[model samples]
Target: MSANPLLAADCQDGCFFVDGRFVPADTTRDVTEPATGQRLGRCAIAGAEAMRSAIAGASAAQAAWAATPPRERAAVLLRAAQALQSHFDEGALAIARETGGIVPKGQHEMREAVVICQIAAGLPLQAQGQVLPSTPGRLSLATRVPHGVVGVISPFNFPLILGIRAVAPALALGNAVVLKPDPRTPVSGGTIMAEAFARAGLPAGLLQVLPGDAEAGEALVTDPRVPMIAFTGSPAVGRRIGELAGRHLKKVSLELGGANNLVVLDDADPDAAASAIAFGAWFHQGQICMASNRVLVHEAIAGAIRERLVGKATHLPVGDGASGQVALGPMIDARQLQRFDQIVKDTVEQGARLEAGGTHEGLCYKPTVLSGVKPGMRAFDEEPFGPLVNLVTFRSDEEAVTLANQSQGGLAAAVIGRDVARALAIGRRLNAGMVHINDQTVNDECTNPFGGPGLGGNGSAVGGPADIDEYTRWQWVTVKDAPPAFPF
Candidate 1:
């Protein structure tokens, strides 16, 4: 038999990561395995005092960290990345216990985190300023500088990456970071990253993790010490944060939710499209922000695509997500499963065809596919954030574009067909942050600004070189030997 991938861990109830030290909190919450209902560990819930201490620590540490040589800062991030790899199994186990994510998915996250770390390490070289031409013995230039302290608010779906996406860049640009992961997945989201950076020899107080509820998120948003905030979650929360940040005149980057769509042309290969749709729709049980919410196919090919997609989804594995052998996992909690159930029920009641799988066995929802789904139904536009997807038919190219772009999101989108040039042209017309010509709707890279438009983001991307822009500000300076006389 294969070795058990998980080992019992000692979370010791709950502890806060403050200034390189693990400080115990006054209270804690139990983190149970969603798949098996076993007690995994506890996470420290940050109180007002804990939040204050963390902010003060980060504020105190910012000046010196920004002064450290860029190469040295980058070296630390590189080491941190490697450290994540070394501790991959432990992190994966924790992730599985907390989120019901399979071990292989956890492994993928670890590898991606490593790449992000390496990418952030190179920021020192890429985050440069430009000089401007000047007249008569005066020099003018624009330089980038850290924003002192950054506040990162991440979600539970992608605990580690969301936290690191903000934290890594903040550190790379020589700013201190105070990251608040979702209260549910503290072990994978908060503690794991903190341990990695500390083990990599980051200075005290450079990075801190505090797991807390919505109030804690608000505190992070309103704290005056934090000049910039990087957030990833729902559009409702994003708007609220933006309002608060705007009032304070703080710099903010938001990667909010999306009802992502995929456009299938008549010329596309039915088999290839089915495979992509199955992976994109059911991956992570549709919790991903970029998960395909709609698959708009040309009417001529809709029947063929639906049959193949149903076959493909039916054959995919469904089991205990924590076991690492299953493609589908349990919902994060009873709430999510209940929500998915209601959406599917309402859609079916409103006349949408239940194509393949819609039944739920406990929290593990079998991969679902629906057809003849029309607008006005709740599930037609609601982000089917479980392993559920819908297929809608379009008679013309213009109709396809309208259907694809009509969703209330502009996060990630895809167009697939044999005519590459035509697909590319169509993609340009679609309103989204990221668009793929021949691939699925879900795609993310370690390098580049990857956020969405409309309700999906606040007009800023959170990864790659764009992160510097999100975490720092530019300052212009001019120097002259003597002041020039002003003409009266």
Candidate 2:
């Protein structure tokens, strides 16, 4: 058994936390540490009936939870934030062990998770609406009220923050949440939140943790009791959820895949551009949605940037994350690594030159770089969620923006240039949801709007103010001192 307190406390049962207690699942699946292929422990899988019960329980509990005083609700979230802070080391370890991220990456997620909780704590009491001037002797106002039950489906990558970003705000805004975490990182993604909230004395049935596969996610999406669905994953899956939620007449928020681009202007420093590109594409093995999948460089400096990128890629450390020294760890599973390798191989075969680091020992695929990658190549067109950098050169700023906008996803984009005004102008022309000047694309803050348009998201955002809009609906109320004269 692992000595990590969080892992040891709940992995043995691998059970769902329903009504604030452990409920054994019908099936148990072994959880593996991707870095070493060691069995961490087993976890319960939520079956159809389990999902049904969880949803029904959430539906039943919503009214009272919503009726709870907003200050009290905010206090609970504040306590949960403290609980997460108190369990920082164990939480970071759990994230690294389950998601195959380096120790620092796990630490980043923990920090963001704490910020998410803290920001959400204040959301309950935020000014959610406005009072309107009305006709004489009448009181009129519009206020935000919680959606009865929210169903959250979070991805395996960056599991802790992604899941909690939704769960905390939804519960704080007086809504019950039925969260379905991806099975791969169940401990970090699901039970960790349960333990934190339970420690905070959240009322029973306010939050249900159901870790399961696609079927369980579908159950959560389709259940009539769940009025709103917040999902983060692949575009294909998000599209399906959109359709299903539409048919069910449910509100859905989708944060999907991205083919993010980091543009390097001719005037940008080659060293600075190269460092940002390497970090953007290789951090966490390029598993995040905002990772730079395409690097567009001005042709005047493309060769210099390419050379520096190759040098950096060949030297990055790749190994197990538990050591806390590796730059890149294993992919989450063999299947993911295989998919990554195949994409790189196909991109090479399609005539892009493979410049450096394409081989793998076990699950750690080395950071791979390719030059002369164009729009038609799979590496340029698809979201390569791996440690592969595809480089495309453009002769002019117009061409760079054009090439970047050709992508179907508009999740995130960045431009690097010494001329801040020029870079900002280029950013303004780019058709992406989030843009950064003189930086890489992999940037997010808990209080800022995160998500983009097009295939990347459904025009929905997650963060401080966005959470309020996402978890609640507007209701207009009007009152009079006495009954009005009836025209009828």
Candidate 3:
């Protein structure tokens, strides 16, 4: 496979934003394109002083931003969305180059980023206070308030959309934001977001972007000035952030890992189920949190589904992300590729039978399917953030639901069955936050609550009007008709 042209470009140096100014970091790190191990760009690494400066900037600008009317705040968000759309092509190219997302997925993510900003722009209106009926002349009310300064730690996968999704809501709610972009893809995601916010006329120092690795993340999470932290990444890091936030009595929203599953019953349309599962499992090389890593089918139809899956997996186009036909791209970096390879090896060693492509070229791992996988294998129990699927068979509806719920993580799950009653029952029983009936577990419309339970780690789902509430706090107020008869 030829290397993506965007990934092969020379390093472009950049800086961190502090107090509405672009300040150079004390150090720099070289970012590489994982697909071919080529240098893409250099990102400034923020240190302790830079971290403090960002927090101060966020704190300084938050009050004035918060004082702005909700409608005005929302208008800013809408403007940011427009700005993002206006620069879509440039943003897409940067995302594709830095994150190794094939051009199409990169473009799609950049568009979603713009949409997220637009959605967040409506938050000021959505954050309206509730009026409760009071006795006689008294009135009771509740209103949402900003959490002062917020810290956002984004992941490498879906960098553009996910990072902006968190930051936009926070800003729309009138809170100042300090964002730590994923080091691997910071050059594209962080710079683009900052520029969009600036173009929308957001106040200087209201939104800041700092780029670096784990230490910078730790600093942001533990800073005393930051009242809340929103993070999206691995379970290990999520747990650490939780611990630190807990100690500081800070608010946190952790969107973490997942080992999602798709259940296809014998009564369902085999063709549709097979196609949906294939797309969910192989999209972005299965790096997504909601991707179907496990496929549970009824014994009667498992054979047909397995065969179809194998054929589809074998033929998926693998090449430079720029190729329009390509469906699977390389893992974000060599480390992810190594971890995926080890998981496949361990699954095979534990008795799972490999049924399709397992070839590796550079950071690209062929879309693979493994059969005969049981609860004993790690692949069955853990989330494998790669394009590998484990197939398991169930004899009955009860057994299928039990098998699907066996994993500790429960981000999302799906059920495919002809009987609506049966599918609804199974969907109800599934422990995941989002359950898809008769379809793959992919997000749509952005109108529903989407997050996870247990070790999946996210505190709140990221869709619908509820997401606006997540970034803000509520306060109840009551106005007494008089100073009270009993003046004691």
What are the per-residue Cα lDDT tens digits for candidate 3 across 185-297? 87666877877777788989999899877788888888999989988888889989999999999988888867687999899888898899888888888888888978998
RMSD to native, candidate 3: 3.4
Per-model C-alpha lDDT, please? 0.84, 0.89, 0.82
Better-scoring candidate (TM-score), 2 or 3? 2
Better of 1 and 3 by lDDT: 1
Residue pairs with backbone atoms closer than 3 Å in model 1 (clashes)? none
Instruction: Say which candidate scores most in TM-score.
Output: 2
| Descending-lDDT candidate ranking | 2, 1, 3
Task: Kindly report which residue stretches of model 3 are placed more than 4 angstroms away from their true locations once superposed.
Answer: 1-12, 133-137, 480-488
Task: Mark the regions of model 2 whose C-alpha exceeds 4 Å error after superposition.
Answer: 1-4, 10-12
Candidate 3's error at 57, in angstroms? 0.7
Instruction: Please list the residue runs of candidate 1 whose C-alpha ends up more than 4 Å from where it truly belongs after superposition.
Output: 1-13, 482-488
TM-score of 1: 0.95
Q: Please say which candidate is ahead in TM-score: 1 or 2.
A: 2
Prediction-by-prediction clash tally: 0, 2, 2
